[model samples]
Target: MINIANTKTSSTEQKNTPMAFLELAFRPFFLCASFFSIISLLLWGAMLNGSFTADVYGGALWWHKHEMLFGFVSAIIVGFLLTAVQNWTGVRSLNGKGLLGLFILWLLGRVLFLMPVNLSPWFIILVDITFLPLAAAALAYPIIQVKLWRNLMFIPILLIMTLINIVMHYSIVSQSPQLMNNASTAMVLLVTLIMTIMGGRVFPMFTANGTQTPRVNAVGWLEKVVIITTLVALIISFNIIDLPTEFKAGIYFIAAVAHAARAFRWKVWVTLKTPLVWSLHFSYWCIAIGLLLFGVAELSATVSQSQAVHLLTVGAMGTMILSMISRVSLGHTGRAIVASKLMTFAFITIILSTIFRVFGSYFLTDYSQVINTAIVFWVIAYGCFVYIYLPILTKAKPGY
Candidate 1:
């Protein structure tokens, strides 16, 4: 029961404010996440073509994976949740110097990952691992004060993500590829679970409001089944439970079906007229499809795990983040919730990027070309976001 209402501010309050950017958590975080994602993708593209080389913490492959999840995606998650929690619990989240400190802590972790000078692994871990727990604490305080027990689920999820991040960094120290791979997969699933929970809460409401349609009621039993199955799939992904391949596949398949059914109740077809709404629906479908493909990969020789993962990462996470930020930034800033024409094009481009990255691998002969093409689209998509939203994020809302 998180409230999604817009916060109102007086024009006099916002006018002539010197440090408006640091006045809220979303401003600095959303801006930084967009820029960081663009740079990271460019570096990844260069590394793929052998034009760039870097000796960073845990090597380039590890850095790319770790940063995209813990670095890029995690920033957006914290920013969104911190902002939303304010609306949820009717208490102010971090702002001003306090918000800046948390943002700097996250930025420092990213800086350490890219520094040419060899840094102590422990130092990097200490900095990188500190952000989430602090964010969790900030999030928990307001909810606890209000006794909003229903909203407290997010605290544990953040803490668990922190634990997984620690394990990921430790994999580098232990030099265990299996551990690294398992931890990475686990993080992906964990984020997907976050998306599942958040999307279920917000998407239907968003779709109904945006489309002027009646709100669809969620089946309580189905909601619980979807979440429980997703948790089981996540546990299986982490290798925490010893399950047969068939059993694992079954759990994933059930989760996928449950997700699809849940989405079907939202009347996704009607959302085609709205880019902001449709993009979310499409992204959620990617999770359903991704889960099915991932389950198939476990039992079939034809399906590759990387393909399934790319579908979830690029299609589900990337598009959903872009769409959510676009809508949230506008709404929070007192602008209309509609997407600009260019922003709509950016949305389409990112979906294309995911298609090329995931399905192109199956059809194309030159794998490098597929990877590079996807990178180009990704850069264009996020580049548009950074360009269009820069002013909107930096300045006070119009009419304040």
Candidate 2:
């Protein structure tokens, strides 16, 4: 029901400054995510062996996941919502030093946390957790001013995610057991919620727009079904570390069915032509399939969590982010919505990456291979964005 086109470009800001940094949303965050991702993964890979040294952080692996989920992905989320919220509410989003300050906080958190806990972890925590709330506040202001109720929901979700990251960081430092479990569960749920919200909003709209056909919502009941099953999957996951095999198996089976049913009604067959569109459709399908495969593992002890999370991470999250970033960049910069040949190549690269990552999980039967291959594809997907869209992200819109 959101009229996306109507809400875009309402309050215009000048883009003629000597600095062209504020031209669009993807500029700072995409740049940051790209550089940080490469460095972060390399750091995590090193830390896995005990070769990595840091002053304050206890577990390197924990720091790795924390950075990936909270640090890296969080940057992308901020860039995205800032732009999207501006579009949805017809308000000018953050720019100038405010935007740069947010990026710097993220950068400093990375640097500070990696070193010894010198003065206090409090300083690092404050910087690490501040970005999301600030982003939420920026987005929420305009939406609330216009009495936009639906978009308002995203603010609290961001807040909760930020809080979860806060708790997770504290738990890592203090060694609180429950905090770790809760944060992991919360991150998975947040990922699922992201899949649903963006999937629902963009999939049908993209399909209809690209195809010049009437729009199609997935299914009336599927929305509720998706949320319930995602939660069910998370709840069952917690029990896996402790509960009996049979108990976990039963719950996972239910979760799998719910996930598959939720995704099936979307009619992915019709979306194949638009790589951007189909990639998302396929990605959501991966979420369902991953859940289903996970259920199979629980019930029959076939595939492992490592395998299933690969499917979700590489298949669902990887492709979705690639598709969204590609589309959002063109649309936001006042460019035509058509993908260039090179951009189209980027799309294919991501799909291949998803396929390789998922297959590495299933076929190679090596956990490291799966992670390695998935990281390759992730780099391919995001690297392609940096390669092709850098100009769009960095330059002012034509009229600006």
Give per-model TM-scores: 0.97, 0.86
Maximum-lDDT candidate = 1
Instruction: Please give the TM-score that candidate 1 achieves against the real structure.
Output: 0.97
Report the C-alpha displacement of residue 356, candidate 2, in angstroms.
4.4
The root-mean-square deviation over C-alpha atoms between each candidate and the true structure, in angstroms, is 1.6, 3.3
Q: How much lDDT does each candidate structure score? A: 0.89, 0.69
198-307 per-residue lDDT for model 2 (tens digits): 77666777878887777876666767766766766665554436777676666556656766665565566777677777777877888777776666776664666555
Where is model 2 poorest over a 10-residue stretch in terms of lDDT?
Answer: 1-10
Evaluated with TM-score, which candidate comes out highest?
Answer: 1
Report the lDDT tens digits of candidate 1 across residue range 12-113: 445534477875678899989989999998998898799998777888888888999999999999998898888888776777678889999999999998
Q: Under the 3 Å rule for N, CA and C atoms, how many clashes does model 2 have?
A: 4
